[model samples]
Target chain A: MGNVSVSELRYIVGPSSYDSVGSKAMKVKKFLQDYFPSQDYLRRLGVCVFEAEANLAIHTTSGGDLLIVIYNNRVKVVAQDTGPGIPDIDKALTPGFTTAPEMARQLGFGGGVGLNNIKRFADSFWLESLKRGTTLVFEVWNDDSTQFDY
Target chain B: MKINEICKTVDAEILQSKGRLHIDIHTAFAADLMSDTLFIIMRDEDPLLLITGVTNLSVVRTASILDIPAVMIVRGKNVPPETIQLAEQNEIVLLRSKHIMFVVCGLLYKAGIQGVSWEM
Candidate 1:
C-alpha cells in the first residue's frame, strides 16, 4: 500500500463579495509561507491564489470554494464555482481582457490579468468550465531548481 | 526611505502606524488597480510600498498578503475605520495623502524610492 500525507485548507467565497476574499487568501498565504522555501515563491503563489478567489467572487453568481492542499513537495490550489462559466476561456485568458464589474475595478482589480497571472506563477495549470461553473487547479512546487515553464 | 520620511514627503496624515514607521522601504509602486500592483510586487525583491487612490479593506488586505510594509492612500480619500483596524492587525502602515496618485508616485520616485519592475 502506498502511504501519503496531505493537509488541506478550504474557504467559501460568496459571489460578488469582496471583504472575505482577501482574508481567506491571507489564511492560505500564511500557511504556505511557513513551508515554502522562498518568500518570492510564496508571494507569487499568494497573488495567483488571490486572483482566483477574486475572480470567483466577481464572476460567479453563487460563489465558490477555494481549496489548498499541502504535500511534502508541492501545494495544490483548486478554485471552483457554481456560476455562469466562461464562454471563451482562450480569450478570457488573454491579458487585459476582463468581464469584472465596475465595482471590482473600483477596488483596484479587473485589470484583466487575473488568469494570465495565475498561469505565469503556477508550475502546472489546468482549467475546466461548463454552463454551471468553472474549476481552476494549479500546483506550485517547493523545489525551485528548475526554471519555470511559464 | 523610512515610512515616516515617506509620509512627510507626501504630506500624508498617518492614519495608523502600528509602530511600523521605522521600517525601511526601497521600492514603490503606484496604481489604482490592485491586480497590477500585485503583479508587479510579486516579482520585486526590495521592500515595497503601495500608493493608491483606493481606500478599502482590499488595499490593506493586499498589502498584508504581500508583506508590504506600508500603503499611502492618495487624493485625500477617506479611509474607513475597519481598514485602519485591519492594517494595525497586519502591522502595516496606513497613510493618506492630499496629493493625487501621480504626484505621490513622483514624490516618492524623487526621494530615491525605485519603481517596481517585472522579472522578465
Candidate 2:
C-alpha cells in the first residue's frame, strides 16, 4: 500500500467582511466530518472553527487567514488576523463579555461566547495578541478514548 | 415536539422547510447571538430548535453546521430571499412568527417545548 497523505485547507478572512465566513465554516466542517473518525470530535471542531471565523469577520481590521491541517491522529486550525489585538485577553475570554458593536449584537452575534466556545471544544488552545494582530491556534485529537464531556 | 407543532403553536409562516417540518426537536434555545447558540448545540446531544429575531445568512449557516433541525425567526421579520435560499439548500426548516422573542418563547414553552439545560 502507498503511504497515506495529510490534507490541508486554507481560507482568507477579510476585515469587516461578513458574507463568506459562514460558507468557509461549512466547508471546514464538511472536511472534518469526512476525515475524522469520531462524531463528537467533528462536532466540537466544527463549533470552534465557526466561532473563530465569525470573530475574525467581526473584530479584525485588516483581514486574516484560516488554515486547517488533517493528520492521521489529529486536526489543527490556525486563524490569524491583522486587527488591533485584544486588549484584555482574560476579559475577552469571559463568556458574556463583548465589545461588539450594537449592530453585531442586534444581528445575533457578539455575545462574547465565541472564544469561550472555542476553548471549550479544542483539546489544546493557544493565543498570541499584539498591537497589530491576533493569532489563535487550536487542535482536536482524533482519539475518542481521551475525549471529555464538558 | 415536531417542528410542525411548534409552527402551529406560534402561528408561524413556513419560509422554507425542504419537507423537514416533521423532524422531532427535543429542546429549544432562544438567542439572537449565534455564538451562544453554537455553544449550546455543541454541548447538547438532543435535537434542537433555534428561535431568534436575528434574521441573517449567518443564522441559517449556524443551524446547518450544528445540524439544528429547524430555525424559527420571531417578530415576523422579513428574511431576505438569499437567507431563505440558503436555508432551503441546507435542508433546514425555516419559520417566521409574528410574535416577538419573549412571546414566541412563552408560546413554545406552553406548547410542551422545553428549554435547553445549561448544565455544561
Candidate 3:
C-alpha cells in the first residue's frame, strides 16, 4: 500500500477546555479505527493513544495539542504541552509512578503509565520531559508487527 | 461463562451495550489506575469486565482503546451522561452499581468470572 499521510489531522484541548478532556484521544482512535477497521487491533491502539493524550492534559499543561500523522502504513503521534516538566524521567517512566494532578488521579489517571502503554502498543517510542516542557513521540507500522496484550 | 449471568451477579446496570451484555466474560480486570491495564493486559478473545470508580469520558475512551466492551462503575456513583454517551458510541456497555469494587469482584468471582485465564 501507499503512504497514509494525515498531517492534516491535529487539534488542541486544554484545562479550561470543557467537562470532558479526552475528546482528542477519542477522535484519533475513531479516525484510525475507521481507516483501518480492525476490531481487535484498533481498540488496543486506542488505549495507547488515549493514555498519551490524557497525560499531556492532566500532567503537563491544563491543555495541549496532539498531532497524528498517518504515513506509509505507519502512524506517528506527537504529544506536547506547557508545564513544569518531568523532574525525574526515570521515575516517571516507572509503571506505578505518577506526577498527575489530583484531578487526574481522582479520575483514574496519572499513575505514570501513559508512556509505558504507548511504548507497549507502538512499534517504536521516545520520550522527553524537561523544565521547559515534555514531548512524547510514538510510531507504529500498520504491518501488524505490533501485538496488543502479550 | 455467560455475560447475562455475570451482570446479574454484579448487580450492574446494562446501560449501553444490551446486545453484548451477556457476552461470555472469560476474563476480568480490576484497577483504578489506567497504567496497570495498559502494560499487563494480554488477551484477545476474552471479554473484559473493567471495574473502576471513575465514570468519565476518558474512562470510556480507555475502554475503547483496550477494546473492552463492558465497564461497570462501582460504588453506586452516577456515570455522567457524557460518559455514558461516549461508551455507547464506542459500543461499550456500562453498568452502575452501589457495591464497592472489592465486593463486586468477590461476587463476580463467586459467580464464576475467573478474571484473565492462562488458557489463552
Model 1 agreement with the true structure over B26-53: per-residue lDDT tens digits? 8888888888776774434467888888
Root-mean-square deviation of each candidate, in angstroms? 2.9, 2.4, 3.0
lDDT by residue for model 2 over A63-100, one digit each (tens)? 78999888776778999987799999999998789988
- The segments of candidate 3 whose C-alpha lies over 4 angstroms from its true place after superposition are A1-7, A16-19, A146-149, B17-19, B40-42, B117-120
Q: Mark the regions of model 2 whose C-alpha exceeds 4 Å error after superposition.
A: A1-4, B42-45
CAPRI-style docking class of model 1 based on DockQ: medium
Please give the distance, in angstroms, between residue A68's alpha carbon in candidate 3 and its true position after superposition: 0.6
Q: Which scores better on DockQ, 2 or 3?
A: 2
Give one digit per residue, the lDDT tens place, for model 3 in A1-150. Answer: 455555547877575343455567677777776567666566556666677767766765456778888766667888887766888888877776776667667666666777766776677788888777878888866675554445
Give candidate 1 regions above 4 Å deviation. A1-4, A146-150, B43-45
Candidate 1 vs candidate 3: the DockQ winner is: 1
- Model 2: docking quality category: medium
Q: Pick the candidate with the highest DockQ.
A: 2
Ten-residue region with minimum lDDT total, candidate 3 chain B = B111-120
- Local accuracy of candidate 3 as per-residue lDDT tens digits, B28-99: 788886655554465667768888887767677667667677888889988788778877767888887789
Q: Which window of 10 residues has the lowest lDDT sum in candidate 1 chain A?
A: A141-150
Computed on C-alphas against the true complex, the DockQ of each candidate is 0.58, 0.61, 0.55
User: What is the alpha-carbon lDDT for the whole of candidate 1?
Assistant: 0.82
Of the two candidates 2 and 3, the one with more favorable lDDT, higher being better, is 2
